[model samples]
Structures are given as C-alpha cells and as structure tokens.
Target: MIAYLIGNIKDKYEDFVILETNGIGYEIFIPFPFDENYIKIYIFEHIKEDCYDLYGFLTFKDKEIFKKLISINGVGPRTACQMIKTYGIDQLINYIILEDTKSLSQIIGIGPKISKRIVLELKDIFLKKYSQNIYSTYKYDAVLALMALGYSKLDSQNSVNNIFLPNDTTEDIIKKALQILAQKV
Candidate 1:
C-alpha cells in the first residue's frame, strides 16, 4: 500500500489533485483545498475487485479519522470526504460527542438516519480513542458559548483549546478565547 506521497501538485480539480513524484503523476482525492504547491499527503488506498482509489489527507490524524469514518457499514470514502469537508475535524468531533444528528444530517449527502448512525457508532470510539481533554464538559460548553456569540465552530474550538488550562472554568476559557479572537480581528 502507498503510505504517503511527497511531491509537487501538478494540477488541481474540484475534488482531486494530480501530484508528481519521482516523475510519476498520481491522482489523489482530497477532502479540502490545498494552497501549497509542495505537500506531503498521507494516503489511503481503497481497492476492490475492479475499483482502485487513493484518498489523501494532510495529516495522520485526518487520515485516521477518514479511516474511522469509512469503517462504518454504510459510509464510503466519498461520504467520509464529504463529512470532513463539510464540518472539519474538530467540529465533527464535537457534533458526534454531543450526539447532534441534526447538524450531521445537514451535510450534502448525509441524511437523518446516517447521521444518527454516525453518532451512535463513532461516539464511543471517538471518546475512547481521541483526546479526552476535548471531550470535557467545560471545553464543550465553552465551544458552544463561543458559537453562540457568532464565532465559527472550528475557530471557537481552536481558540478554546489553545486557551484552556486545567482548573479553569468554562467562563474563564470563553473570556480568554474572546480576547484572543478580538486580537485576531
């Protein structure tokens, strides 16, 4: 299996990129856009009797998340890509942890049933395998508060995570995050 590719981006399309490595060009599907011409993409190769596809992620964590998503019975690589593209990693983790099927269903290809299944199936795995700090009630509450104040979920989660410290209350985290966000503007 091809673990990863390090090369220059020969071309880019809506959902895939052509990377040239060692004089060979490989078409790899991506979940999000890449601005950098040179990159090292962790790869996931899907092979069946007649189908072969390459899915690439910027980080190992992203590759692992993609693998986890595709492990579900009905979720395929494309659906997993769509999920990541729509919600991103942190927000998707938050949605799953909160069991918010409605938000998950808002993705283009995901419906209510699949959203519920995604939550039901991945919640425990995420709780067990991923960072326990992000699953804390205080952090979750802080992220929600930031979102309520009109911040994007990804930005809110990132800010909160960056400012969080042990023994700090949700209010403290939110206040610090707001200050950090203010400076960024």
Candidate 2:
C-alpha cells in the first residue's frame, strides 16, 4: 500500500536500493542505477504467496509502463523493470510501435518471441501518442525524406533516432541523418 516515498538513500545494490525514512530502512528494487543520495520515488508494491516486493521509479510514466508490462502473461515485475532499464521509456515505446523485435530482443533476458509478443500486445495502446509527440513533425518528415531517398525503414530509423534536439528543423534532421548514413556507408 506504499504508493510513494521521499527519503535519503542509505545503500545501493545492483538491483535495489535501501531508502531510509523516519529511521526505517525500506528495500526498494530499481530498474536502473541512481547516484543521488536523496530521492522522491513512486512505488509499486507486488505481494505474492511468498514475496512482498516494492519497485520504485523516478517518473509516473515509468511506473505505468512497468504496470502494463507486468500485466502481460509471460512478463514479471523484474522482467518489466529490466525492459525499462534496457531501452528506456521513449526508445522502448518506439520499438514496440515500429515492431522492431530485433532491437527489442537485444535486452538480456528478452528473446525474439517475447519481443514480438510485447509489440503485438502494447503497440495499439501506446503508438499514437508516442508517434505524434516523440517523432515530432520535422523529425517524421525527415524520416519520410530518408525513405524517399532509398534508405530502408530500419536504416532510416536508426539514422534519426533521438537525433533531434529542441528547435531542430526538418532540414536539420535530414542533414544529421545523411551524415550518419554516410558514416555507415
């Protein structure tokens, strides 16, 4: 029932952190590394027959993604956390929407089959918002231009992934993508 926590981190482990609040130390499993000694984190508590665990995230988006992932038949909290840790929220959503199972399967415990299943199950639910916002108008236009220039979808995607910064225009993205593609050639 612990929904959130704001405390000083007393210790850190490879897969978890010990957060002390009001003199009580609570062990919270985390998906990624955190260097801060003080943190305010959202939490998800999973209680089962022999296990009661708390998983923490710095953002609500991550918590929601974790919840969605663990709801899948073959995915558990740990697996879901690993997924977020590996690809991060933005890249993971893009991979799912694009049905790029090869990249998705690159994570340690994920295989081709699971990656496909993840895409099949979550793409429709998340694709629209992510596609519209994350890609942005100019970046999307740049991808289309790359496609028109004969780049394969995957090549174009890799060329421009997260390459746009604030205020970058279509021309800027196209230039960057071409530069990346040229380096690969």
Candidate 3:
C-alpha cells in the first residue's frame, strides 16, 4: 500500500489535484483546498474490480478520521471527504462527541440517519482514543469548565490539550487554557 507521497502540485481541480513525483503524476482526491506548491500527503488508496483511486490528507490524523468515517455503513469515501471539507476535523469531532446530529445533517450529503450513525459509532472510539492519557481526568474537568464558560468544545479541548502540564491540577489547566483563549480574541 502507498502510505504517502511528497510531490509538487501539477494541477488543481475542484476535488482533486495532480501531484508529480519521480516523473509520474498522481491524481489524488483531497478533502480540502490547498494552495501550496509542494506538499506531503498521507494517502488512502481505494481499489475496486476495475478502478483505483487515491485520497490524500494533509495530516495522518485526517487520514485516520477519513478511514473511520468510511468504515461506517452508508458513508462512502466521497461523503466522508465532504463531511471533513465542510466541518473540518476538529469541529466534526466536537459535533460527534456532543451527538449533535442536526449540525452534522446540515452537510450536503449527510442525512439525519447517517449523522446519527456517525455519532453513535465514533463517539466512544474518539473518546477512548483521545482521552485515555495520564491526565485525562484533569483534562476532562478543565474542558468542562471551559465549556461552562461558553467556549466551544473544540476550543476548550484544544486549549486544555495545549496548556496541560504534568504537574498541573484541573484548576491550573483551566487557568492556563483561559489565558490561551484570551490571546486568540
């Protein structure tokens, strides 16, 4: 399997880009638009009986999320790409964690059923994978405090994740996260 590709962009299209590497061009469908002349993309190759396609992501996290999304029934690669392109990885995760099916259903191709399925299937997976760190308890409390202060779950989690220190208490994390959030405004 081709894991990744580092190349110069040869052309840009609505959903895909032509990347040239080693005197070869690869047409890769991307989740979002990129303006860089060169890039390193984590790739997911899809093979069918008579077709082969490549999906490219800017980060390994994005590629992993895409894989998870496509694993759900009724969620195709294109639908997964659209969801990511529309809501972004962080906000999408937030929506899933919160079980905000209405928000997810706002996407072009995602209906209520698929949105609910996405949330139901991925919520535990995300929480387990992302929140099982040594400081998970403290981090979770800090994130809840930030959310109570009216910050978005995405912003709260992001601040907490960035500002957490090994020795800090939940209150310390909250204070540091507030400082980080204040700097953004």
Candidate 4:
C-alpha cells in the first residue's frame, strides 16, 4: 500500500490528480471533490477496508487536519471529505472554532446530530491549525479561465469548471483549449 507520493504534478483536477513519481504516474482523488481549487495540491493516502482513496491538502498540516476530521465516529472518509469540500478546511475549521454547528450541519449527509457530534468531538483539535492554506490554488480558476480564452461563455466556463486545472497563462489557455478541441476530431 502506498502511504503517499511525491512527484511533479503531471495533472490536477477537482476530483483527481496525477503525479509523476519515479517515472510512473499515480492517480489520486481527495475523499471529496472541492467546489474550487485555490492552489495546486499535495495529498496523503489512506488505504483500508477495501478502499483505495486519497485525501488532498495544500500542506502537510492540512492533511493532518483531515485525519482529525475523519476520526469523528460517524464522519468516515466520505463525510469528512464532504465537510472539507463543502466549506474547505479553513472554513470548516473556522466553523468549529466559532462554534458554528449550524453551518457544518448544512453539508450534505451531515445531519444536525452528526454535526453537533463533530463539533463536540473534534472541533478543538482543528480550531487554529488549518488557517495557513485552505482555499483553492488553481490560477484564475478553471471557469473564468476558459471564458477568458474563447470558449464561448457558457460552454467554456462550464467545461472548465467541471474539468481539472489548465495551469497556464491566457495564451496557454487558448493553445490548450484548441488542442483539446482538436482531439475531438
């Protein structure tokens, strides 16, 4: 079982990332997909109970905070991931610090009871730890980035929003988008 990987970020996505490690590319996904990408990322692997999964974070401390997240009794990996994905590690940690169980409960699958329990059990651990980096890391975001190119308005934004990072400048956006379009032929 691979505990973690360090490599050149060959590709990055909202749900998955490909790292080129030791001449091999590894495919990894966070427990839950973030709604946005604040920065490119790094990840920790958790393989157990018949599952091969990844939890991504901008820093090693973020990964540690995620570990604290899943430890809550009912949280599990998916729920923990949902919490992070819904509000990000920073926001969620902020909620816990501020005693905002209501916001945490709003996450899908996190009922009132579970929300309270999450706050009760583990809030203190993550209170001030995740402040360093919690937002996304992608440049210009994928959506605005596509529109800034020439992918029409709706089609480009939606497609870029849905796919992974196209980490490049405006010129690169045009070149890559055209390359992607050409592949359809």
Best by lDDT, which number? 3
Q: What does candidate 1's lDDT look like per residue over 1-185, in tens digits? A: 89999999999998999999999999999998779999999999999899999999999999999998888777899999998988788777878876889998887778888888888999988877764545476788999999999999999999998988967788899999999999989
Candidate 3 lDDT over 1-185, as tens digits, reads 99999999999999999999999999999988788988999999999998899999999999999999999998989999999999788777767776889999998778999999998999999867764333666788899999999999999999998988877888899999999999999
* Tens digit per residue, CA lDDT, model 4, 7-115: 6766777766776777987776664444442344566677889987766666666677778877777777667766777777666776776568889888778888888
Show how many residue pairs clash in every candidate, following the order shown. 0, 0, 0, 7
Candidate 3's TM-score: 0.71
Pairs of colliding residues, candidate 3? none
What residue pairs clash in candidate 1, if any at all? Answer: none
Candidate 2 residue 129 Cα shift, in angstroms, is 3.4
Which regions of candidate 1 deviate over 4 angstroms? 131-185
What's each prediction's TM-score?
0.75, 0.73, 0.71, 0.57
For residues 49-122, what per-residue lDDT tens digits would candidate 2 score against the true structure?
99999999998888888898887777889888888888787777877776889988887777888888888998
On the 0 to 100 scale, the lDDT of residue 12 in model 3 is 95
**Which residue pairs overlap in candidate 2's backbone?**
none
* Candidate 4 residue 54 C-alpha distance from true site, Å: 2.5
Worst 10 residues of 1 by lDDT: 129-138
TM-score of 2: 0.73
